[model samples]
Structure formats: structure tokens, C-alpha cells
Target: MLHYSRTCGTFTGMKANGTDVRPWLAALVIGVTGIAFGACDRRGADDEQVAAVEVAASWRSIAEGVRGDRIRRDAEMLADDAMAGREAGTEGFDLAASFVAERFAALGLAPLSDGSYLQEVELFWTRLLPESARITLQAGDTEIDLTIREDFVRSGGFGPGEERVDAEVVFAGHGIAAPEYEHDDFAGIDPAGVILVVLSGAPPHFETDLRAYYSSSTVKQTEAASRGALGLLVVRTPVDQRRRPWDRYLPGVGRTDMEWVDSGGVPFGGYPELAGSAVLSQGAAERLFELAGRDLSELFVHHGAGETGSFPLGVSAVLERSSDQGRTVSANVVGILAGDDPRLRDEYVVYTAHLDHLGTLDDGDDQIHNGFYDNAVGVATLLEVARAMTKLPVPPRRSILFVALTAEEKGLLGSSFFAQNPPVPIERIVANLNIDMPFLGFPIGDVEAFGVEHSTLRSSVEKAAHAAGIVLSPDSMPERVRFVRSDQFSFVQRGIPALNLKPGSISTDDSFDGPAMLADFLDNHYHRSSDAGDQPFSESGAERFARTALLTGLWVASDKDRPSWNEGDFFGEKFATGRVAPVSAP
Candidate 1:
């Protein structure tokens, strides 16, 4: 497995196998795994002016120093020239990997496998012909036919051979069976032997907060799989550009593959139809909704995705699609750090961040969507921690793993891959602290952990953040379904308690001056081009941010027991026992 140790201020690769892989690491050399939190907080007199972490000076100073020349150098090297748009398998991305490997080498990190730093992820890019879709409706002699692309899209779902069918349609409104909302879209339908037609996402026409109900693919995909249907179709009215559908197929782009998992085992029909998740056109969707006595013309206002609510419609439609689809291989970078206490070291603590981002957009723009803010920063943090942890006073009691994942943007693919294909046993991992956009400094408040309140890590988080003087952000907007959107979601799906750490929304007390800065940051750079160094960052601020990350990681790393998931998440039922696999020492 990949290995990392801090020497000086960076990580270097090392190996210490045959050491207790579980139950508190035994041979953890004390000085080898020391950590340094917030150097700005150092009380000594000889330290340089922390730059006060104030205005641009403060932000720039800390950012530059902590990030050091390496960050800038690596950013340039890892990021493509024109952003080569690092699409998987593209020569440009291979170059990008080379750059990361070089940095890992310079940082003292070692390849988990042999001498080669390249993880070599494999995948298939099946760019479909614009004409890959075909659908027709037969309500009467009207015989209405829909156009492709604009009207409807045929996302390749069938694997290998073509998946074409001529069957009656069923309108499963919302395609949801959420007992929490007291709604069952498939209340009285047998989707078997028929093509199940349902709306793909939450209804844009709904009159309430549609964020929760419509944000995740689980509604359309999971519920659809439960019912025995030959195929499934999601009625499409509009698409979210920020959330593209094609990112699912790229290498190191969707999910990591090292964990123990059954790829695609998540049957799509939470209902009972073994169908693929594809979007259906509005006109074609209307034909099926008409069966339920709903009027499309009455609700759809072409003025702009139209004003609608986020509710599920029980209308169904007829669908037919076929394509030559295939499976691909991706990897999650995994490495083990041995701890001192032989008994405690075996308990594992997994630190993860998805390395994949929206690869090349190819709208023919001269720039690449390098995903600088989306998560390259998080990956960088993982690298930094690897270095810091190596400097620990000695190996801690528990083993720490640094996992650079793929496909997290594509529904936590890399993490999911590892969950099913773990290098060790799944039961060994005790807790997971996942990072995303760590550098996107939050408002002056405690860490706003998405799922912490629902897991065993809640108290631990509060204690740790308090020690660091971090104000915990409450679940003020729980309806956003923030818990299900990141890489930690995969571990949570496996019943492992995990937490996603981020700065408070934004604060006025600090450099950026709080609320306004936070808002602009989120709306503008959270996933955009400006997230790069273009937005000034103080070296002190960077240090504070890095320190908080470094400190929190230490707290978690020292824990003896695995964290537990709370009782409320949708995926909680998967784990009958409330524990994840314990960690092991290298």
C-alpha cells in the first residue's frame, strides 16, 4: 500500500509491513509521527510576524508559507497549461498524474505498490452519437414523436449489447417510497414486465424546498431498482449544468476501486424494474403523465426552466433506449501509517478526499475545468497531513490512512469502489474524516460538519473543534441534503461514521470580513476558476486553515473506538451493527 511520513515539513514514502495491521499499531516510532498545528499560534518570541492573518497581507503570508513554493509549483505542474482539461486517459491527464507523483516523491511519500507512483486507473469513454436515443409515443392517431438531445437524451445504460424494449409504461410519481414524507410513488404498481417511466429529478414545478427531495440520484435510481421492472426511465424536464451526467464514465473520475465493493450492485430499481437510469423528454413524458390526468402545457413555462416546485409527480411514460455500454476500472490511493501501541494501532482511521474533478469540459473553451477549488485543495491537504503525521512524537495508537479517491464528484465512486474492494477488512476502519475544499476558508465559526450530529463522532467533533476554538456550525439548512453529496457519503453508506469538515459559512471578524466573503466565495469560486490563487490567501490564514485540519486529524487519529452513524440518515439501515472496521498499523 502507499505510505507517507513527514520529514522536515513534508511527507516522504516509507514502508513498515508485517507490523500489526490492526488493534492499535505496535511499532509506531514516536518522533516519526509528530504533528504541528497552527504555527501562527506559536507563543515564542523569535517567530516571524504572523502577518496577523488580517487583510491581504495576513492571508497571503500564511497561504504562501504553509503552501510553500511547492503548492504553487505543483499547482502549475499538476494543473494543465491550458488546463489540458485533464480528462481521464487523455495524455494531458497522464502528465498531470506525473506531476502529482513528482510532488509525492519530493514530499517524501512512497508509492503504496512498487516503485512506480502512478496508480494507473482504467476506464472506458463511451461518447455516444447524438443520435444514440430513440423513443416514440402512441396515445392515439396523433402519434407524437420527440427529438433527441434537446427534447430527450439517451444516456447509455445497457451494458455491452443493446437494451431495446417495446412495453407498456407505468407512471410512478416521484418514484419515491420515502415513509418520512408519507408518500409512496409506487404505492400500487407492479413494474415487472413493463418499462417503468418516472421523472428523473425532483419536479422543478414543486412549490416548496425541492433541494432535499430532488438533489440525489437515489430517489430515481434506488426506488426504481426495488420494483421489478425490466427497465427504468426518468422523465426529463431540465438538466443541471453544474451537475453533468457524463462525468460518471471517466477514469479516476467517478469512484475509487481499491476498497471492497460490488460495482453496480446497487440495483437501480428500488421499485422492481432492472432498468438503467436515463432521462426522458418532456413531450414523451407528457404522454405518460397524461395517463394520470396531468397537463404538461399547464405547468411547463418555457420562460426559463419555469417556476416549479421540487415534488415528485406520479406520472409515467413509455421509453426505449439501447447502447453499447461497458464497465471500467478506477483506483483509490491507499496507504497505511503504523502507530506505537500494538493493540490500539490496529484500529483504523480513514482520511479521505476525492481526487477526481470535472475533467475537460471540451465546450471548446481554451481553459480546462481544473477543479482547483472543488477538491484539488483537499488532495493537497491530504499530502500535507501525510507529512505532518510523520513528524508526530511517535506513531499514535491507531493507524492512519491517506486515501486519494476518484469519482467522488460522480456520486462518490472511488470511495464506493474501496468500500467494496478494501485492501484490508471493512470491519477494520473505525472512523472517516473526509475533506473537500479545505482551503475554502469558512466564516469565523466552529467546523460545520454535515453528518456529525447524526453519528458517534458528533461529541468528538465538538470537543476537538472546541480545543481548536472552532465554532461549530449548526444544521441550519438540513434540507440541503449536504450529507449525501460528498465522498464521506460512501463510507456512511457502509455504516461507517464519517464527518466532512469545512470552515463556518463565513465571518466578518476575519480577513475576508465574514458573511459577504463567504457568500461570494460559495456562489462564485466554490467550484469555479477563481478558486485558484487569484483570490488572495494569507500565508497565516493558510496556516490557520492547515493547522485546524492538522489538529482535527490528530484528534481523530488518537481515538480508540470507531465512530458510529446516527439513526436518521437514509442509509443507516444498511449497517445492522453500528461499527466500522477498526484500523491497522503498517
Candidate 2:
């Protein structure tokens, strides 16, 4: 049997009793499984290189089976006006779900959960009572009353009681405490019985995935609550303002928030200790910093340089809010292409794309936020990947599951629910490949595979990128913390290796600037009513992305061994706790 090496996140030759068996194990793997191990002999290691090349060669034909025309058709349908943006729990979303289910049926795939294709998910919807909300800061003898929608915005309450907090405020830097990176914002400061004033993102020097983990608002709030902080006030930095304009958030000031509910009706991801929270505008943040004997600009400079220190703001803040909480239901469309191999058929490789968008707004001139590039293209790409996988000459060794999830726009609720209550046994899942808003502004010459840095799936992704004639590039905007923003994060939290690919800055045509086009899309069209189906779309780019994603999934599914987290990985050490079968071999 092939052994997983934690040292390098790869398969090697070793017995279960920790004996070295590389010589015979390598031969057995190649002869019986036709799968290549990443290890090599001394010197040039020519044999391992040849094995990788052969694998890439075999994947080329299968990758080419992805069709641009099919992807275009699916995207047009999903982004059509009649779908009303495919928001979860609406009739429009139901129509979109029906269409996806019909397409899966036509593709000859089996329903993944209970032979029904639709896995029902319950959601708790909470809307803030703007009329009842108030926020103010008191510094010694001065009092500053902040205006809602202009100065700050609050989140919906997690419980029925009216949320209220009256506590002293502390400038807790980025509000991060990661010992692995030797950074702690609460090192000498006492966080008990206070509200924390934190910056929006994480330090710039940390690696991509680690930065993403720390930059998450949920993680920051958890850290705060665990330290006995009563509330939080997140300050918008100038860097974040430049990346995402503040006006964009004005439309969502009083928007409803959603969380997936468990069997006991308790909402997931609730921080009860944190009584209230608010995000401050740049101007409001500057005012608060001025009240303390500090300047926001100086603090930003120190933060950019990865310097860590926290000081009490010597300001007390009062925040009060209430919400109307209710329940709604949505569904995840799941289908499976069973593997031909009997021994590995039960183990699964999952592919996911969110099927929901922002839905229609009440005040916009054009109400429908047709999310064509935000996720319509992503779901379309997932369908085409499924089609291409079906057209392969032989089935992959492990079952391939395709999931079109809902409520991703609402904090990845659908995926969170599915990962927690999987149709199959949780330990049977081997890996996850998720597709979100992969920008197709220009013909993509390179791609960025997030989360590959932490898992053994990197080898398969490299081979897939080579087979598809695409270069693999590093994350260009780690400050956005995208690795934790998508549905793949849900699977990653469950100890599954996951990947989310985005188009790289490289453009095939010298006349076009891919990075500029992507920036334009984000600034003008992202999550706006302008993200309609009529926008210019590159079918060729979608097809390229489909090929890369399909080949990557196939590579992992065909291997005899399962993907493993890197040795001493942050995610693995924290969440990889369970009794899981090591290999798919019998």
C-alpha cells in the first residue's frame, strides 16, 4: 500500500509500522495502480519527472473535451432576467434550481443525497432594526454620537434579546493573536470587559493562506470574544478603501444577514459573548484615533510594516441594536458520477460552485443584480466540468460529486450546512475543488489555485495546469483574503483539501491588460446591478478554466492515495481530528 508522508505532503513507500519500504512500494504503486508517487531517488530524479510528464499527457485529451459553447449557454440561462438573480429562498431561485436539476438529469448523473438531487438546508434570516440602533463614543468629557449608514453599520443580532454594550474601547491593532507567525495583538493589553478597535485585514508579510485565516472577520470576532471582549469596532483602513470603495457598502446598510441553522434550531457561527459589533467608516475611524493621542495614518504605517502593539484608546463606546429573526429554507443541488473502481468508488472528490447571487435591490434603477461574472459563470463552468468528466475514456477511480450550493452570498451558509451534515459519511470525502467568480475578462494565460499551498493536491494541480497549457501563478491580492471568502473554506474546515482557482493577471493577447480588466470589473460591476448577462464575456477563458478544474479533480480522484495536509499545517493541526481511513485501496 502507498504511504502518506507528512513531511512533504506526498505519497511515499513506507509500512504502517513506520518501516522504510520505498524500493518495492514505488514499483507496486506504478505496476498495479498506474499512479505516480512524488518521491524520487538520489541524483537527477529523472524517473519521477517522466512519470509526471506521462500523467500530464494522459490528461490532455480529457481536458480538451470541455466545450466553450456549452458553458456560454449555461451562463446565459443562469444570468437571465427571469431568474431574478437566483437569490436563495425565492421563487426565482427555485426556478434556477429546477433548471440545474434538469441539466444534471440530462447529463446522466445520479442524485447525490437520497436520490433527490436537492439537499434541503435551513437558514436563519436576521434583519437589523435600523430605527432602534444607536452608537456613541465618550472620551473623558467629550461625547461623539455617530450617524448610522454614514458613520457606521451594524450586524444583525444573533439572539432575540436587544443587543447592547457599554464598555471601554481598546485599540487592539489588527485584533490577531497567531502564535505560529509570532504575532499577537493582545500581547500585553488586557481585553477583558472592553470593546476592541481593530483594523480590517491582516499583516502583509504572512503567507497567503495564513493571512486569509487571520483576516477573516469571523476569526477576529472569535478571538475577541474568547478574550472576554464585550464588542468590536472594525476600522476601515485607507488601503481597504482604495481596493473596495465605501459607497458600495451604502446600499447594503440595512440588508438582512443569514446563517445556517442546525437540527436544534441553533444558528451556526454565533458569538454570544460579543454583544454588539460595528464597522466604522474611514472618517469615523480617524476621529476615534484622534481622540486617543494617535493618528490613523501612523497606525496604518506601523501595521503595513508588520509591527505589533496595542494600546488602550481611553474611550468608552455604547452600542445598541435589535433584529427581527426568522427562518427560511434553501437547497444544494448535488449529483454524482460513480467511479468504476470498486475499491475506491465509495471515496469521493467533490466539486462545488455557489448558485446564489445578491438578488434584486429595492432602490437601484435596475433592481436585478444579475451576477453574470460573480457566479453565473462559475456555476456554468462547474456544469461543463461535469460534462467533460463524463466524456473521459475511463471513469476516475473515486466518485466525483458536483454540488451547486445556495446562500454563498450570505456568508457561505449552504456549503457550511452541507459540510456539517453531509449526505455520505464525512470521512469518506477526500478532496474539494470549488469554482467561484473566476474573472473571464480576457483570455486567461495563467491561473491562481488557492489553498494548494497547504495540501498534497499541489502536485495534481501543477500537472493539470501543465496539461491545459496554463501557468500557475501566486495570489495577486492576498489582502482580499479570498481563500477564506468562498465555499471551499467550509470543506477546508472539515479537514478536506480544497482548491479555488481564479484567473491570473497574464493575458494571451498583448493588446489587452488582464489585470486592468479584472480591476474594472471589480470596481464597476461586482455585486452591482451592472453585472448583467449583456456584458462582454470570454467563452474561451471559461473553457480554459473548465479544463484546468476538470483535470485537477480527475488527477486526485484517480490516485490510489488520498490528499494529505502539509506537515504541521495550521488548518490540519486544528481541524484534522477524526478517525478516517488513510487510503482508498482494499
lDDT of 2: 0.80
Q: Scored by Cα lDDT, where does model 1 land? A: 0.51
lDDT (10s digit) by residue, model 1, range 457-503: 77656644443334456754454456667888778767777888765
Instruction: Report the C-alpha lDDT of model 2 over 1-586, residue by residue, as the tens digit.
Output: 1111112113233322454434323323222122211122223222553364443434545565577778878888999999998888877788888888888888888986467889998888887888778888888899999888888888687776587789999989999998888999998899999999999888888877788898898899889988999888999777888876677677776677888888998889767577758888888888888888688899999987899889898889999988888888899999889997899899999999999998887546898888888798999999998887777667888999999999999999889998999988888899989999988876677779888788898887776654455557778877677889999999999988888987777776666778888888887888988888787677677766777788788878988789988888888877776748477575
- Cα misplacement distance, residue 526 of candidate 1 (Å): 6.0
Tell me, what's the RMSD of every candidate?
10.6, 7.8
Give the Cα lDDT of each candidate.
Answer: 0.51, 0.80
TM-score of 1: 0.71
Error of 2 at 155 (Å): 2.3
